[model samples]
Target: MTQAQPSATPEFRRVAQRLRDDVTGGVYAPGQRLPAAAELAERLGTNRSVTERAVRLAAAEGLLTTRKGSGAFVARILKRIPRRAAALLGVPEGSEADGTREAVEAELRDMGLASRYFPTMSTERAPQDLAGLLGVKRSGKNVLVWETRVFAVPIGAQPTDPGTPVELIRTYLPLDIAAGTTLEQTDVTPLDIRGRLAELGHRPTEFTETIEVRPPLDDEAQFLGLDTDNRVVQLTHSTTAGDRTVEISVSVFPAHLWSFSYRWTAS
Candidate 1:
């Protein structure tokens, strides 16, 4: 009787796992080119198609990267877990004005990493949804939109490879509140939005964040250097000072490079 053929699923997984082990165990160094699919199949005793699937699976896991016209190569995985920053949420009590941003930069500095910020400001009418959230009539009154790009510098990196683009932040505030205030500046503010609002007699009382996971848009993918298979974490932040919504911000972070943690009393 003919022997039953082994299922391709298990074979594929086995090949992928073996390659993953090799990569993780330093058999293949970071940025090192992986064996060709045909060669890998011959060595692993699997067919070329199964080996190719295995490589693709590894790439999806962020363990490898495939370039068009070039074969798969090991990815340079950042091993350190990034420090959690509440900047996306708001400033904390007893912290300095721009404490949120400072805190994040400090943490990166501590880890021998560097950071750069690019800030831009513009005046635009609030979108329908944002206007509703801010309790403003959709009558085309302009709002201040401030965008900042946060980049993380790798240690010993050259100017040509200065750093990795980490996060994109966009903050929105009603024009009446932002006009004539530091919030309208195109430069980094000495304080965060909430702090600046407090300076204007608006005491920030609460903030609510809504987080969603979805595929990255084309622009986001390009800016973050994310592979086509990767997704991103998009967060919408709303801060209220008593009865008024003082600020609304949206931040996008690469899923592979960030995580969030929260602490609260069990009251």
Candidate 2:
């Protein structure tokens, strides 16, 4: 990989920064072969391990591409998104309609990405981590945890363009229904979740959300119809009743294709 001289920072950090700057600055032109690790270490006056770590970090940040035997090369710079286009995911002022999930899903089908649902917590089989999240022992009582993945036709060959399908998930419950059945059916929506909780004699008091940006996991990529190399945006949400946490969910959006946008202004 292209090597850069270390700065005053820590050895590994300095080396990583220099490499990032060089790649981003186009000094190491896209697709250009970088020096081999050992040669790069020699050029940077660092050890091989340090050089390797720096290169790995750069690769993870989408700055460099590494081929199995061909070695590493500068990654092509992605086109810079204009502010207007980047705002597509955001909900404009008063533009969101209540009870729009079905409509949205239909549109997604038109785009070629279809949506599917699975439970995070299930009556038949529940993962151990999910058991803990539900505040039960590994083999304790089960609860409903719903997950949904949406797939859309690519705007292009690469999974990094507008109109890509991603997944939005909600892991709430049917309240006191004794969770024997998984909600595999597509008929459930936010209102359905509320209705089920109500039928169980529980109130859907409040819902909260936490947003984050991160890369997609392997399964996430598969569900979103993306390559494993694609990045995703993640948002975690939870619902509660009377100060008790009842449900949690994580939604993943393909970074190059979809984004989440919400707008608020001074009232």
Candidate 3:
């Protein structure tokens, strides 16, 4: 890709993109030594400082890693595996492996965001629809559940930066299983929770999603690092199993610094 002329976008950003494209376009093969810093600066028609900043940004984005004494080299790229090997092994970042969870957390940390999940309960009656999602009998007693906190951060580490506060999340599961099961053991997602329940003989065949935008609650402000004046984007998802709906979950996100995306294509 050709580099763009510098304007509002930083000179370093343009330099970074050029370097990225060089590696991606095969000009700098995997494991190859990049041009020396001075040489890269000359080639890009910029100074050493701009080139250095670009290299650092690329490294932070996982495109490159630096070595002491030795100059920067192209990061190694593994060869494509055969179909059978690919089927048995998945890389979490690009493949279906469990490592994806850590990858997500790493991305969050890189952006300086914080997250916390806790187990709590709701004494309030499950709404008719939510009760169906959890698969619990409507007439049953009030039950315990899972509550969580999630925070969004800006590009920098400072806490005073503007951010939205959200109520974050609330999840409920059946108490039919022995009481006091550790939260870790019982904290399956709505989709997977039904499967766990089914393993013990329950089936959830229905699910629902409700999304809204609203002001954050007081508790949400404390956990999400939000000012009392901020509002949040809320998503409430419910799932049902058998005659009883067995799971209810709500996820909240700050409005100012959040992004949401989804796409579907022919399978």
Candidate 4:
């Protein structure tokens, strides 16, 4: 049974529960489109807003899918990705067992899934929290940003399958640190960012990471083919060598598709 959700009204909950029951009871088969908005509203005896709210909640639960122009449908259950074991996502970035961003790509490849990465570079004014984390003043500090999206193409699917986006990565580097390196070049992506930092005398010896559950940001949700009702796993990873922090990365993954396990020692 689904518990009452935060900020959801009694009528909204009632409608959502009915929809969930209908789907589970086989009244609506998997991958089947739901009735029109007016039909659903009339059936539920509620406004279209209430029906939409219910659909959103169901989508978050992984029982329904809401697509633009196509409307909501019963979600077709797919094989689930196993939980990921992590140490700095544990033990820092890159190494296979550490569950670095690359580890996920590796896993997908092993499972016969193919992906293409689209990368872009730009600069953005540092927000207060991130600015402080980078040891810079938000008032004037700007960071070089690299955003990469990994789109998953299904086996034997057409180029225009509109392959799903499985991962979104954003890396931030201080301007002074990136001034003369490949990090500043949008077209030349470094296979190992930490490795490059080492050549500049900044070998990362320690890293800090934080993981939390939350709703996806608007753009994030859209890219991940999700709605506001979905929960997403967000990780903020920072690396440092001795006294200076060298790099920071923020990664977002679909909560339904990824799980993270962390291990650490007590100080």
Best by TM-score: 1
Off by over 4 Å in 2: 1-121, 124-133, 153-165, 168-191, 265-267
The CA lDDT at 88 in model 1 is: 33
Report clash pairs, candidate 1. Answer: none
- Cα error of candidate 1 at position 224, Å: 1.6
How much RMSD separates candidate 3 from the native structure? Answer: 13.4
In order, candidate lDDTs are 0.73, 0.55, 0.54, 0.73
Question: lDDT tens digits, residues 14-64, model 1?
Answer: 888888888889998877898888988897788998888888777766677
On the 0 to 100 scale, the lDDT of residue 3 in model 2 is: 67
The segments of candidate 4 whose C-alpha lies over 4 angstroms from its true place after superposition are: 1-56, 73-83, 86-99, 187-191, 263-267
lDDT of 2 by residue, 17-121 (tens): 878887888778866899999998887778898888788777665567677798888754322211111112233222212223455555554554444443343
Encode model 3's per-residue lDDT on 1-267: one tens digit a residue.
978644226777678788888777888775688889999899877889888877766554434556668877664431211111111122222222122224444555554554333444444445576665555668755444556554334345366633323235676665654145443364543223444554554444555556687877887655654444455778665545545655566767655444444333444
How much does each candidate deviate from the true structure in C-alpha RMSD?
Answer: 4.8, 9.3, 13.4, 5.3
TM per prediction: 0.77, 0.47, 0.44, 0.71
For candidate 3, give the lDDT of residue 248.
Answer: 65
lDDT of 1: 0.73
Number of clashes found in candidate 2: 9
Better of 2 and 3 by lDDT: 2
Q: Per-residue lDDT of 1-267 in model 4, one digit per residue for the tens?
A: 998665387788799899888888898886799998889889888888888888878888777888889999886543344445445423333332254556656766666666677888877776567777776657654787888886776567687766666678888887778777877766644246776676677767777878889999999988887877788888877887778777788888888766566555565
